[model samples]
Target: MYICICNAVKESDIRDAVGAGVSCFKTLSKNLSLCTDCGSCGKKAKQAFHRALAESGASSNVVSIDAMSTAPVRRIQSTIKVSASATHHQKCIKTIL
Candidate 1:
């Protein structure tokens, strides 16, 4: 159900955004960064956005969040140390892949 695995975005999250007055894909993407990584989920995310928008019955007047204050933010650790990776919790995040 996670349309954007890189960002951990789910379809239900999109629906909730629509319900909360996100009337277009661009605004929603700005907040949640949908389809921003890898671009594999662009089609599916767009489809879900439209479907949710239609179901929400909200206006198509192009409402925006944060008024385009800044680019979407994603936090990343500066580096991963081997000792930290040995911990079970961090092991999953800093994995062999």
Candidate 2:
């Protein structure tokens, strides 16, 4: 069912956003832009959102600000090459091959 006609937001969209860890109205609005237009669907959308959260078993105590971000997560790769890991001053040619 469509919750917000202005933004074309549906009930599934709110549920999906909630499943993705959107715990508050701000994040839900940022993600779906649901109740930002004429404010008519605000109450319905909020109810659906809360219902979805309850159905999804999400706690109100936990918060995730990044849940609103659609950016893909990235990992930083790094490498360290130690020539000599010994405490001695001996000349050792250690290769990480």
Candidate 3:
């Protein structure tokens, strides 16, 4: 998927960069600039970063994906749910009056 249309940065581009030792967001921003422009693709870029890290055996850098994919097959496990609203840094949880 094309995460950054303005820069022509695809998800695979980010992944390959991650595999080549670009692990964290700071380095990713500096190296790939996937999230520096419009800011619309930041979240997806971050997701692709972590996925790339996990897939490339950078297990310590990526927690959530590793937890989901390589987690033990035990009886009970905790799952972290991230809402779309949260992705864009909006706190949408509300209370009824």
lDDT of each: 0.63, 0.62, 0.61
Error of 2 at 85 (Å): 40
Q: Which regions in candidate 1 have their CA more than 4 angstroms from the true location?
A: 59-97
Task: Give the per-residue lDDT digits (tens) of candidate 3, residues 1-97.
Answer: 8999988999999888877866456667668776677889877887787778778887543323333555452311223234432322111111100
Candidate 2's C-alpha runs over 4 A off are 60-97
- Error at 4, model 2, angstroms: 0.2
Per-residue CA lDDT of model 2 for 1-97, tens digit only, reads: 9999999999999999988877666568778886678989988987897788789988433322243556432210011122342211111111100
TM-score computed on alpha carbons, candidate 2 = 0.60
- Native RMSD of candidate 1 (Å): 13.9
Model 3, residue 60: C-alpha shift (Å)? 2.9
- TM-score of model 3 (CA atoms): 0.60
Give one clash count per candidate, in the order shown: 0, 0, 0
- In model 3, the Cα lDDT at residue 71 comes to 46
Question: Which candidate number maximizes lDDT?
Answer: 1
Q: How does each model score on TM-score?
A: 0.59, 0.60, 0.60
Q: Model 3 clash tally?
A: 0
